[model samples]
Target: MSLLFKELDYRPTPIGVLSLRRRRELSLDIDVYEIKLDDEYLMSSLFTDAEIALADLGLADLAGDSLDVVVGGLGLGYTAKAALDNPKTGKLTVLDTLPEVIEWHQQGLLPLGEQLSGDRRCELVHADFFGASLSDIAGMNPQRPDTRHDAILLDVDHSPGNVLHDDHKRLYTKDGLQKLATHLVPGGVFALWSTELPEPWFEENLAAAFDDIRAEVITFRHPLIDREDINTVYIARKAS
Candidate 1:
């Protein structure tokens, strides 16, 4: 391997061939970490504003201490790190479908891996976030399956309509949204990160299960293209 690029780890996942790579950006003189599923790029360390905002905006809505938060994806650990950064967060549970991803953090492969794994308040679990959200008895936290959380932040699918798996589509519906709320406490928040703008139909379904719904458009500089890119964060609160 050249000094410019290196493959940190590669594994076969149920979804696809998952790979973690680190490459040096000659133009910027910095190392860039990227995750890919098959040939498609899943996430990159260079672009993380929206991931962090998902935690910041969700936690900002509630006024309390010792907040128990759940992050639906563990990609690069940016969102998980942000949740732990908040002083109010007492426990942060991160769920990812692929166990390899969780192990990467535990073994310290990603940049934020050591910080996330070493944090006393953070717990990384291997599970299906979508399934847990819809489970009648089990909540997002595996250790305390019956306990409800203060906030659930999701960054899994590309958008409400563009899910990575077919089963995830149900969670975007009105009925599924209602079930997801059952795992949350009254006044708890559900924040979703979408690659595109919010859809009207999704908002209608979100309204059925949540209150004070807001779609936040977050913009950041695209390092590869040198242009502004946008990601939407939908924040909704359960009825208190």
Candidate 2:
């Protein structure tokens, strides 16, 4: 089979230069859609295990029906789509700082964009998630105020310590995390997907803000690298 490669879209945004590229992986023998923020790779359709897992494992502890959720980042729509797959999910609102990224999905630029946009349960908002905390939770819900969700899934930065933007650093702190919990219900869950391994210090920060804080190391085989790889997803519950 012939290799395929192309830069589908590229534009300047407040964060940096956002790009959408498609490349065929010879080993996998399939096309892979990838998104990039400046020089850093943001997401790829090829390895969506961790992204989808972010929704599945994060919301695993949730109970009852009519669930409301807020996904902090909308990379390639994998996590959003996964959340919508849950039958109990009543509404899934996605918040992103980049307007262009949201536009890409609305315009059917990304692979799962059309499906996610067409779903009544999924709503993409153009706003800075990191900036939204207890001090200033305005504009987070867009249509309503003081809208708390059952689960808040995050996958914006690399990790609690490794952030793509400097502004994101505060979101990992105890104070920032405490503020984040204000957007959730008393028993709501905060799930964070990180590229770094499980860090005890980070868990300590989470413990200070919430209860039942735990980190799970997700291991999977990388077809591209032909080796085993690992990532972490931090799960915590707000005070009940």
Candidate 3:
């Protein structure tokens, strides 16, 4: 049974109310008029290692004065925030399906957004990462070169196998991966943050889409208040 909802904290952002929910377990939820759990607040969700790795995998290759990054999920804005922290990154466009999630950042529920959004380097868009068309991304920054993303970091669901939303499974499918391929520049890296190692099928699909496909298993300790959990990250790159 869940305990009485206790307030851990709150932030105002693009999503609106970003608050920590203290029940039997700590979770992060958002609300404008209704409540929804984005992920287990302060639990296994906020894995910094995965977030940093996602950003680094892409930034490491680019030599240009300005690098552009596309982040598929904005959970607490950790990955997006980390990308912005990098000097090599010139712009970061974060897309999330839930507008409320964007509000959470815009309103300042996550302080990282508050710090990074105003840098003129961060742009947040409300749309499904999978459904977002190439035209849509191009519209965000018209001057951006064709096949613009230097890095594509996706933290959409738990993993390719353990999907929270049915539609997300497409991301690991061949067709979905093909779409991703179109967005990435030559040699650009695609990083996926997963709760665990993805199925072999995911690797096969990635291989079929990109010339060089690889996965990196990253283990890190969680910063939860109660228990410690180890999380993993999967990194796949497009062959130059």
Candidate 4:
């Protein structure tokens, strides 16, 4: 079998608690790491299917609506790239908490980063999405008027039920969900990528925040290998 990219060990300075590795495929670079505490295979570049699903399914109907999009995680830049592919997207904002992740992308570890960064429509912010203030986003491009986003796609951590940080659990709570809902313009959409099926309670919580909600299982064939895998995509639309 042919390999996409070669894997190289990566260790970020100062954040010595965790170990990360990167591999370069024919066109894309993948990062694999063991996050501290949980010790789970915290993240990988293998599941870009989930990322694209978040972008494609979430913004499918809003094709030419002059939309602003906010993506919570910048993993591999797949979601951001997919979102930018839509002509309907007027502005694209991506938020990530890890400076290392951003730096890696900026330095060309992720092949798509340079193109996305160079795009006049895309903005990359290094901050925790949950803590980002509305004013901060509005300030990104002062020339453009402040407008609530048409879609928000979040893939910060794992599914709500399988979160790596205890604090992230609040993002799934009623209050947290309400905060997310408030950021959306009327009739806007919110999409989340889940590594597994979300908990029943979490699905109910999503229903409470939006008037319409839909969940689908997306199957993808591995880019290099023929193996098939599935991930969950949750899409909700704000009430008009």
Which one is best on TM-score? 1
Off by over 4 Å in 4: 1-20, 24-40, 63-65, 133-146, 222-227
- Relative to the true structure, candidate 1 reaches a TM of 0.97
Best by lDDT: 1
Q: Encode model 4's per-residue lDDT on 1-240: one tens digit a residue.
A: 233434433554442444345444543444332223124455566667788878999999775656889898776788999899887888898887777667766776556868887899888877777765233343222334366778989887778887756767787877777777877788989899987865678789999888899888888887667888778989989898
Model 2 lDDT per residue over 85-132, tens place: 988789888999888889889999787899999998889998778877
Model 3 lDDT tens row, 8-110? 4555544344455434433533221122354333222344677677776656656776777888877767688778878888878888776766775677654
RMSD in order of candidates: 1.3, 1.6, 6.1, 4.4
Residue-pair clashes per prediction, in order, are 0, 0, 24, 6
Instruction: Write down the lDDT of every candidate, Cα atoms only.
Output: 0.92, 0.86, 0.66, 0.73
- Candidates 2 and 3 compared: the better one by TM-score is 2
Candidate 1: clashing pairs of residues: none
Query: Which residue segments of model 2 deviate by more than 4 Å?
Result: 1-3
Candidate 4 is scored at a TM of 0.81
The residue ranges of model 3 lying beyond 4 angstroms of the native Cα positions read: 1-46, 133-147, 223-229
By summed lDDT, which 10 consecutive residues of candidate 3 come out lowest?
A: 27-36
TM-score versus the correct structure, for each prediction: 0.97, 0.95, 0.75, 0.81
